[model samples]
Structure formats: structure tokens, C-alpha cells
Target chain A: MKMISENVWEIPREGKMRVPARIFASDILMEKIKADKSLLQVKNVAALPGIQKFSLAMPDAHQGYGFSIGGVAAFDMDEGIISPGGVGYDINCSVRLLRTDMMEDDISSKRKQLLEELSKEVPAGVGRSSKMRLSREELDEVLSTGAKWAVKKGYGTVKDLKHIEEGGSMQGRPDKVSDLAKKRGMPQIGTLGAGNHFLEMQKVDKIFMPEVAERFGITKPGQVMVMIHCGSRGLGHQVASDYIRAMENKFGISHLPDRELINAPISSELGQDYYHAMSAAANFGFANKQMITHWVRQCFDKVFGSNENMDTVYEVCHNIAKMEQHMIDGEKKKLCVHRKGATRSFGPGKEEVPEDYRDLGQPVIIPGSMGTASYLLVGTKKAEEISFGSTAHGAGRVASRSEALRTVRGEQVKKELKQKGIEVWGHSSKGLAEEAPQFYKDVDEVVRVSDALGIGKMVARVVPLAVLKG
Target chain B: MKFKFFDHTADIKFQAYGSSKEEAFKNAALALTEFIIEEDIKAVQEKTIEVEGMDEKQLLYSWLEQFLILLDTEGFLLSTIEELKIDGNKLKAKVKGDSAENYKLTGDAKAITYHDMEITHDDGWMVQVVIDI
Candidate 1:
């Protein structure tokens, strides 16, 4: 590995690697990133045909199945490939931030009550299903329109849709999704599935860019916000599984270095079908977060009495491949950018950003674990040039789920969190213990690297007051 | 219950052991069951599933995926693999479990992965696999 800049390191294109693998991390973070096989996975991604520029690993990069979480790679539409592992099994695993007019002091007394209401209002945990079961046609609408279905269902005003990525809906082909995937997704519409997914009530502790922060509805310190983190549920998983199997069948696995890295050529019919189905599943995810937002609004009103002025700040998904145009070698090229565990950090003037915040740049949300600090960042133009408009997703895992379970008991973690003035609600003790805050890398440092790299600059910081885990 | 867990950085990985390949596959199902739910599962009903694959690994993946399908579609919590047979690349199994609502499930296993998956025979058969939870 060679140091390209102060915070950037590189593994020059070697042997089978078609492109160099670049990692954005400080010297200390580099050590943790190198602890696992994540960097080697980056090298492997670099070897994939038609990958553009460099295969990049964000600061929070950690070992995942095939492609490391926090890995980003864009591929040529005609010559490149799209892999299921690259997009991850959980399609559109995303985060949504709702800014509230109320402050910390306002909710201090009723914090636990609010959490209890949220815990009831929003379905969570493994095997938990919602009362809202969608029929084939209704689900097809959701798969095709994404969160717009929620808007039609009156989850939030049309203004709320504006703040979401891709207007909370992609051009999804519901026809491409299988009946099996649809059946799996049906009862899971408003549910928050397990593993690192949570709903946290947070308070603004600090603000770095007061000007930009104000524009994002963070007018002052001590402001309260709600962060929802989840994905498309079983439907998305089945879609990924179905496609992976199909790809393996169509193209023999003998050539794949890692079976999990199975891919179909982006230009192939099968690939297009997978992309459409994947987007439909992504739409399901959007509709999901939107519906959750509706229930959250109701819960807030029921608890606080006045629910007016609560609005969405921004929502972003870390998984999925997008057909985007980027300047490669000073020439614009249409590419399929796959961000496994990376956030899009597109800067100001991008048409994709909401109209209200167009001039100020897109709002990038980075949520921390159980009882930690989450950050809001301003996307940068420099990010588009250097890292293909991508940044780290979260405080990447430092220890395995089993390792964390061995280290601490759930009761102990809850007690520790209570000492920090944070309340906890979770489905199972083992699940809580598995997501102990210690298992994650320091998010502050991760954000620092992003800011230093001029990719996604920090705007405001919020700490959790209450956490609901699944 | 002839299975034990191994440390994986982000997800769960396990190795199931038995006297034969079929038994190893059955043990893998039990391992999956234990990982998802902590409570004792009563086999009140039985359901059968069949899958075909071009190779052994795909066969294993297809076979294990059926449990997840049952869980998602019918809310069936896995209790046991009552009977199993692997005829070349085709597999058929009878599984027994109660409705998932009867138990508290811990993990939402998204899919099974082929990462470092191995089905080996050395005296007793051992099959190692990782699941995306």
C-alpha cells in the first residue's frame, strides 16, 4: 500500500487487478481496515471487468461477504458487470432523519414515553409483521412507485417526498420481481427487520456549519430529531437470492473467484431484469420508511400533543446500483455505480438534490450505533471528482456479532447506556448485546476523515437520548 | 444440534457436523433454527420442500433457502429436519416447526452465502456456511 495523499492510500493495480484500489482512511483507521480481509476484497473488486477508475474503500470499510461494506465501484454500462454481493442482500438499506421543532428540554420528561409509543407504533425485530398486508396489486403499485404510494396513502405531505433520495421512488419494474419475492415482502411493508437496524430519538449536541445547518432545519442546538434505519425486508432478500441463483445458473460459477460475487453483465437481459427487480425492491424500502414516518408522526402527536412542524430533513440509501453520469478522465461517461455500504455525497448544483437545498448541496446523514453520536454532512463537489460522489455509511463494525456477545451481556450494555443518560428498548438481549456500541469503530473519527478528505463535510452532530433496537 | 458457530466480522457463520452429507445438511437447518429463535420449538406440523441445483454447493444453498422461504411466507419457525435425501444435485426434505408467532426470533437471516462454504467428508461429514442476517 502506498500513500497517495494525507488521508488516502492506494494499492497500485497489480497482477489480475484491472484498476488500482484506493482507500480513504487516516493512518490509524487504515490499521483497523487492514485488520480484516476487506482491502483484499477491494483488490478483488478492482479485478472485475470494466470497473471505472479505482475500486474505493471508504473509512468505515469492514469485511462483508464478498465486497466489503463501505466499498464503492462504478462500472461501464456496456463492458462492466453488476454483482448481487456488490449491492448487498438487503436492498436499499437506508436512513431517514426527521427534524422536529421541539428541543431536548421539551421532550426530556416524556422521552421514555415517546420511545414506548414508537416501539408500539412501528413494528420491529425478527419475524415481526405489520397489520398492513398488501395484496398483489397494491404491492405492485408500491414496487413500481416506491414511497409515492405512501404519499397517496397520506403518510406525509408531498413536501416530504422532496427530501428523499430519488424522490423516494425509482423507476421500478414490478413485473420483473418474482411472485415469491412479492409474497415475502407483502406483510413486511411497515416493519423494521433486525441486525443493526434501529429507531433512535436524538438531540443536536453541536453544530459546525451553522449556516448550512439552519437551512437543513437544524436552527439551533438542543433540537430533537428522529432517525429511522432499516431496509426492504424479506422481499429484497428474496430478490437478491433469486437473481444470484439465476446468474449462477446462466453463467457458470467456475470463473468466479468468490461465489457470492456472482454477477451478470450490465448490458445483458438478465442483468436488466435484476436491476429492475432490485429497484422495485428498493421502492418497497422507500415505501417502508415513508409509512414508518407516518406512524412516527402519529406517535409524536399522541405523546407531545402538538405534532406540527415536524418534517423530513433527508433520507439516503447505502445499498443499490444507480445509472449515473460522471466525468471519468475529464470525459463524461454513463456508469452503474454500486455502493454497498457507502452514501452518495453529491455536491451542490446536482439536479438530483432537493430544490430547497439545491444551492447548499445535498444533506448526507450518517447514523451512529445504539448510544452514540450521529452526524449530518454537506455533500461536496470534490467528492464527485475524487471518490465518485461517495462516502462511508456508518461506524463500521470492529468486532463480530458473536465476539460482541461474548464480551458483554445485554443487561450490562443497557445499564452502561443508562449511565450515559440514554434509554434502551430492544427485542432480545442477545440482539442488544450483539449491537453493543463498543463493537463499532469510532464514528467521530470516521466523519473526521470524510471532512478532511473534503468528501462529505460535517454540518451538525446529534446524540441519542433513546434507542429502539430490532 | 450438531452445529457450532464461528466468528464472522459482520454476520453469522457456522459449521454443522454429522455422519453423512444429508445429516450435515439437516444439522445446518437446526443451526439456522437455533440462531433465529431462542425458545424451544415444538414440531406441531410438518412441511416438505424440494430443490434442484447444478452442483453440490448450489444444492445446499437452494435447500437451506427453503427454510427462509417457509419462515417468510407461512411464518413457520423451523424445529427439525424430519427426513432428508440428496439424490445427486436434487434434494427433498421434510421439515417440522410451529408458527413463528409462537417463538421470539432473534435474527432476520436474509440469505445464505457461498462465501467460504465447504461441504467436506473426513470420517464424519462437516458443512460450513455463512448466512447474511
Candidate 2:
């Protein structure tokens, strides 16, 4: 690995690698990243055929299935491949930030009551079924229509769709998804599944770019906001498993470096089928988050006496692969961009960005660990030039669940949060201990690296007031 | 006591040990069940599942996938294996457990992966896999 810049390191193409690997990290973060096999995974990704430029790892990259948790790579349209590992098993696992009218002074006393209501309204944790059961046909519609299905069913408003990625729906084909995937997904939708997923109420603490923050509906310090972090539940996982088996059957894994990276050519019939199936799973995620948002609104009304005005600021799909047009060899061409544990940081004037905030750039919501401060950032053009318009997703995990369990106790974590004036409601104490803040790298440090690299600009910073974990 | 969990950065990695191949596969399933609910469940209902794969890795993958499907489709959490037989790339298993409503699930095992998977039966049966949690 060679230092390309103050914060950029490069691993030259060697052996079977088709392209070089680039990682964006500061010196302090580099030390932690080198402690794992994520760097090796980055090199493995570069070996994929038709890879564009360089296989990139974000500042928060960590070891995951086949790709690093914060890995990003764009593939050519005709020669590239699409793998379940690249798209992520939890298809379209994403984050949504909502702005509320309530201020710190207004909710300081009633925070506990509000959280209690939210816990009842939103079913969370493992194996918790949704209150509303979907018939086979209805679930299929959700697979195709995404959050729009929720809005049509009176779960949310039409206006909320504007703030979500892909307008809350993609070109999905439910027929492409297997029966097992649908069966597994039917009961899991409209739930916030466990492990690093959370819903937090936060108050804006600082506004670095006053203009951009104002454009994003973030008005003044101490303004309260809601952040929902979750994904498509069992449906996404099953689609990945079923297709991985299919791909392995058709194309053996002997030629590949890693069996988990089993793939199909981009133009193959099975590849397109997997794409549609993956899109359907992505839609399930959008609808799931949409329903949770509706329940959150109702819970606010139940707790506050008067309904609060909560508006969707923006939503970004963290783990997904999309067909996007970008400059390649001085010509605009469409390519498949896979962002696994990364966010799309499209700069100002991109047509893909929502019209409301297009001039100010897309709003990127990066959630930190529990009881830690989250950040709101704006996309940048420099990111498009160097890193394929991507940024880190979160403070990536640095320790295993067993390691965290051995070092920390759930009760001690809760007590520490209470001392910090933050309250938490969790479904399992063991889950809580595993997700302790110390188990993850520092989010503040991550945001600083992104800012320094000019991939994402910090607009505002917010600290949690209350946390709800599954 | 038949299985041990190792430190993996972003997922759960475990190795199950047994005196025979059948025992090792059963122990692997037990590790998955314990991840969700550590408490031993009472056998109130049973399921007979048949799994087919192209190879031993797929055999293991198919076996784990059956239990996951049961958890989501039937809400049946596996407790104990009443009988299991593995022949070539196919396996038949009869397992018993109660409904998910009977217990509190602690973790979500997203999927089984082929990354760093290992299976050996020369000296003694040992199977290693990573669960995408």
C-alpha cells in the first residue's frame, strides 16, 4: 500500500487484481483498519471483472461477508458482475432523518413518555411480527411499489415520498422473487430488526453550514429530530441466499477468489432476474421504514396532546447497487454502482437528487452509535471526482459481540447514558451490551475524515436525547 | 460445550465439534438455536425437513436455511434434534421445538455465508461457518 495523499492510501493492481484499491482514512483510523482483514477484502473486490477506476473503502470500512462493510465499487454495464455480497444481504438497509417542530424546551420533561409510546407503536427486536398482516397480493404490491404502497394504504402522506431515495420506489419485479423469500418477508415487514439498528430522538447542537442546514429544514440549535435506522428484514436475506445458490449452480466458484463473492455477468438472464429480485427487496425496506414513520407520528400525537409537525428531511439507501450514469474515460456512461455500507453523496445540481434540496446538494444522515452524536452532511462534487460520490455509513464496529459482552455490562451502559441525560429502551440486555458505544470507532473522527477529503461537508451536528433499540 | 464462538469483526463465527458427522451437523444447528434463545425449549411440536445440496458446503447451507425458514414462516424455534441422517449431498432432519411466542429471541441471524467456511471429517468431525448477524 502506498500513500496517495494525506488521507488516501492505494494498493496497486498486482497478481489477479483488475484494478488498484483505494482507502480513505486518517492516520489514527488507519491503525484500527489495519487490525482486521477489511484491507484484504478491498483487494479482493478489485479483482472483480470490469471494475471502474479503483475499489474504494470508506473511512469507516470494516470486515464483512465478502466485501468490507464500508466498501464501494462501480462496475461496467456489459462486462461487470453483480454479487449478493456487493449489494449486501440486508438489501437497501438505510437511514431516514425527520425534522420535528418540537424544541428542546418543549420535550425535555416528556421525553420518557414519548419514548414509551413509540416503543408500543413500533414493533422491534427479533421475531416481533407486525400488527397489520399483508395478504400475498398486498405483500407483492409492497415489493413493487415500496413506500408508495404504504402511502396509498394511508400509512403516510404523498409528500413524504419526495424526500426518499428513488422516490421511495424502484423498478421492482415481484415475480422474480422466490416464494420462500416472500413467505419469510411477509411477517417481518414494518419492523425494526435488531443489531445496530435504532431510532433516536436528537437535538441539533451545532450548525456548521448555516445555509445548507436551513435548506434541510434544520432551523436553529436545540431543534429536535428523529432518525430511523433499519432494513428489509428476512425477505432480503432469503433473496440473497436463494440467488447465491442459483449463481453457484450455474457458475462454479473455482474461478473466483472468494466463494461468497459468487456472481453473474451483468447482461446474463439470471443477473437481470437477481437485479429485479433485489429491487423488490429494496422496496420492502422503503415500505418498512415508511410504516414505522407513520406509527412514530401517531405516537407523537398520543404523547404530546397536540400533533407535532414532523417532516422527512431525506433518506439514503446505505447498502444497495444502482444503475447510475457517471463520467468514464471522458464520456458519460451508465454503470452499476454498488455501495455496501456507504451512502450516496451526490453534490448540488444532480438530477437524481430531490428537487427541494437539489441546489444545496443531497442531505446525508450518518447515525453514530447509541448515546453518541450523529451528523448531518451535504454532498460534494469532489467526492464524485475521487470516490464515486460515496461516504461512510456509520461508526463501523471494531469488536465482536462476544468481545463486547465480555468487556461491558448492559446495566453499566444504561447507567452511563442516564448520567449523560440520555434514556434508552432496549428489548434484550445482551443485545444492548453487544452494541455498546465503545465497540465502534468514533463517528466524530469518521465525519472529520470525510470532511477533510471533501467527499461530504458537515452541515450540522446533533446529540441524542433519547434512544430506542431493538 | 460442543461448539465455541470466535471473534469476528462484523458477524458471528463458530466451530462445532462432534465425534461423528451427524453429531457435528446437529451441534452446528444447536449453536444457531442458542444464538437466538439460550434457554432450552420444551419439545411440543416437530418438523421433518429434507435438504438437498450440490456438495457438503451446500448441504450445511441448506440445513441452516431450513431452520431459518421455519423461524420466519412457521415461527418454530428448533430445540433438539430427534433424528438426523446425512447421505451424500442430502440430509433429512426431524427436530422439535415450541412456537416463537413461547420465548424471547435475542439476536437476528441474517443469513449463512460461504466466506471462510470449513468442514473436516478425517480425524474427527468439525464444521466451521460464519453467520451474517
Candidate 3:
């Protein structure tokens, strides 16, 4: 193990570890990891084919399916492997931020109305789908095209696509996705499904870096910001499920150490097919968020009477794998980076970023639970050197939902959030209890570690004013 | 003795009572798997599986999830549970199951969810488990 810094450590390849392991955490975080099996999962990821540099973990790392939740590992295109667990079941489960010209005072009186409208417009809960339904052919196009499908459908503007990561579409063949996945996805596009999915109305409460905030068009304390957290919904879930089962069947009874760690080499047909389907789902997720953004604008218009001038700040997906070139061992090489429960933190001047904000790097939108402080951060060069240009996803869970329900009442949590002046709307009170802010670690602490490690630099802090939960 | 469905989330948690902790865990897994597959436990083909855990509670969790994984992946529904032995964190079990396609369940579970799950000894023995539907 190589200690890159006091907080970061590298686990060099030993035995079956195909690559090394890189961990980003403070001494205190390391203690927490030692108490959990997340570190072991990270080591297992290092064993996957095509992994380069190290299997990296962010500060908010936690045990998950195959790879640790806050993990990032890049594999070579020719030899790397992709696991469904690495991308997670949620597909492009992601976060989108929209900085508005209006201030908190402008919307405070309408918070309740705003939330109600949002809840009404955005379907939530299990088996919930939006009012929009697509034919089988349309669904196929959506699965193949990603956000570009939504733009062509006029669900969102071209400018919205420009601000999104990868131009809101990762180009590749998506015809490989299964028909079953497409069928499962057709009805769920533009819907908000359950389990930690939400849309929150927030205000820029603090600005940590004035220049960065100004460049991103975020200014004036109390300015309202909208954050939406959701994913590719059933389509993404089906894609992951389909591939996982296929992989298991292929490796059946093979004495694989873990069933969830099933994977295939990138060069194989199975691997390429999974990648195409996953990318399609990621694109669908981008389109889903874009559709939600359009509805959010409509909700705002109904409440505030105008959305003609509202703009999208940034839209990004946290759960995904992509092909990118990064400096590895002093030489740039192509790699397929898998980031689950982690966000890309590409430093400034990268062509991937929009020209206007190229110098400021990508805007990393990290959402906290409703009634907590969310943050907007920018990628740093230090992150490229250390974490393969990645950062923590959110305040990782400290307790499971069931554990929270034992002590925290759903009604009580709802009342508490209301008392805090945040309007809340949810499908069920029980769902709220599962997502109680107390069930997670302090998001501020998670962001603080990222800033301290110089992976992501904070730009602004946002506090929720209204929330719509699934 | 009695089954009570807790508040509706993605998973459904129910409480069951037995005379001993071991019995309670066994019954909980049986009930949970039954709830997931919505079928009679008598038709499944008998299969034995072993899972090692760190402690009795962890062992119970793994044991239940092992059956859950089977039910989820292979559509194997439990028909009969013959034995459950726990030695520290290690759990060994023999369960019978055929196919889940023939079994009728109240709901189809996507997978065994981590929403709300617990195994505790109360007056007799009580367990609460939530299955993702």
C-alpha cells in the first residue's frame, strides 16, 4: 500500500488484484471504512480486467453491490471489464442544478403552491409513470439516443443539452439493449420513481468562491436554485438486471468469489452490448432529467407566472461508465471509467466542458437531504492527479432506512421539515422517514473532505426551501 | 403466531413470533420468501445452501438473503425448510424448493431490499423484514 498523502492511500496489486487501489479519505474516514467492508469491495474492483491506475474510492465511500458506492475505476477499452454493480441499478441516477434569477423572497410565499404543483406534475412512488407514454418504436429511439431524443421531441432546449455532461448523450450503438428493457422503460420516462429520488427548491445561501460562482451565472445570496435527483427509472434498472443475469448465467457455478461481481471483458460482445445499453440508459436519464426540468419550469411558471427567462445551470449523472483519455503512468491512454455513487470532477481547460465555463471546470452538483445544505463545487487539477478526476456523490448513508424508522417517525420528520420552513410533498409519510436527513452523514462534512483533499473546490451552498419526494 | 404488515414502503415488513431465536429466524426467512414468491413452500425442490456470517444475527441475514437471491434469480420458491444450524457466524441450512413460476404471491418482488430488516428476540421471538416489490 502506498500512502499518497496522510488521507489518501494506494493499494498496489497483490495476488489477484489486476490493478492497484486508490482511496481518498481522511484519517477519521479511514477509521469508519475499517469498521465496514467497503474497502474490501474496492479491492475486489481492482481485480476486474482492464482496470487502470487504481480502484479509487471517494471520501463518502460505503459498502455496496460489487464496488464501493463512492468508487471510481477506469478500465482499458481493449481489456477492461464492466459490471452492472459498477454502474448500479439506478442507471444514470444523477443530479441536475438550475440557478434561477429569482430570490428566495420571490418564491417564499409560493413555496407550498410550488411544491404541490411539482408533486402533481412529477409522478412519484412505486410503479408511477408520467402522463406521457411512448410507443415501442419511440421507446427504442429514446433508449438509443439518450437526451438527444428529448431535444428532438422539444421537451427541452438545445442550451440545456450544452450544459449537460457529454452534451447529454454518449454516442455509441444502443441497439444492443434488450427489448424487455425498452418495454420496461417506455412507460417510466419523465417520471420520478421512489427511493431517494426528489426535487428540491433551494437558495444560494453562501458563496465560497466568488469568481467561480460569478462565472457560472450564480450570484446574489438567496437566489433560488432547483435540484432534481432521479435516474433512468425502470429502463435503467432492467438494463442492469438483464446484463447481471446474463453474466451470471455465463459464469454459472464457476466459484466466483461474489455473485454480484459478475462482469465481462470490454472486447466481448456481452461487454459491448452492456455498454451500449448502459449508455443508452444514461442518455435516457439525461433526457428524463431534462423532461423533469421542463416540468419544473412549468411548475414555476404556474406559481410565479413566468419561465420565459429561466435557465438551466448544469445537469450531470453520477452513476455511469464512459470512455475518456486520462494520463496514466505518464502517458495518456483511453479508458472506460466506471463511477458509481461518484461524480466526475474534470479540472479547468478540459474540452469536455463548455467554453464559457471551461476555466472554472465542471460544476459538481451535490444534493443533500431535504432540510439540509446542498453544495455546488468545481473540479480541480489536484483531482486529476489523485482521484482520476472524481469526487464524492453525497452524504453517504450512515443508517439503513429500516433502522431510521425505529427511532424517527415519518410524521415527526415531516413536521420538523415544515417547522424549519421547508415545504414538503411526498407519496407516503413512511417514504419520508426512510430519507430522513439524520439517516445520512453530515453532507457538509463530506464536502469539506473533498475541498480539503483539493479534489473539488466549493463554489456555493444551497439550502432547501421546498421539496417533492418520491 | 401473527403476521402484521408494517407501513408500505418499497419493501413489506411483517412480524412473526416463535419460541426460540433460531426458530424465529427460520420462520422469518420462510415468511419473507413466501411473501416474495407468493407461493406455497411445499412445491419447491429441496436444496441445501450454506452461508457464513460474522455472528448469529449476521448469519440470519445472510441465510435469508441467500434464499432471496435464489428466489430472485432462479424463481425457486421454498417448499419446506428442514434444518438451520448456526455456529457462531456460520449458518448451514437445507431448504426445499421447486419453481417460483407455479407459486402465486401477493406481489412480485424485484429483489430483497435493504429498506427495513431486523431479527430480534422479544417475548418469544420476533422478526421484521421488508421485501422490495
Give DockQ for candidates 1 onward, in order.
0.85, 0.87, 0.07
lDDT of 3 by residue, A1-470 (tens): 66787678888888789878888887777776666678888998888777887899998888776777898999888878888878887878899998788988999998888888888888776545568878877777776677888889987788888889888887535586777667667767898777688899999999999889987878879989889999887667767767876776575525545556778888888888889889888888988888888899999888998876567778767889888789988998888888999999989988887777898899998888767999999998898888888999988777655577687877899899998988888776667887898877778878888999999999999999988987
- Encode model 3's per-residue lDDT on B6-72: one tens digit a residue: 6442235676667876677778776776555443556537778888754454455556666645653
TM-score of each: 0.99, 0.99, 0.81
Candidate 3 interface RMSD (Å): 8.5
After superposing candidate 2, which stretches have Cα over 4 Å from the reference?
none
List where candidate 3 sits over 4 angstroms from the true fold.
A1-3, A172-174, A253-255, B1-133
lDDT for position A328 in model 3: 88
> Candidate 2 docking category?
high
Quote the lDDT for A131 in model 2. Answer: 84
Cα error, residue A235 of model 2, in Å, equals: 0.6
Which candidate do you rate higher for lDDT, 1 or 3?
1
lDDT of 3 at A265: 83
Ordered by lDDT, highest first, the candidates read: 1, 2, 3
- Who is ahead in DockQ, 1 or 3? 1
Q: What are the chain B TM-scores of all models?
A: 0.96, 0.97, 0.79
Whole-model Cα lDDT of every candidate shown, in order: 0.92, 0.91, 0.78
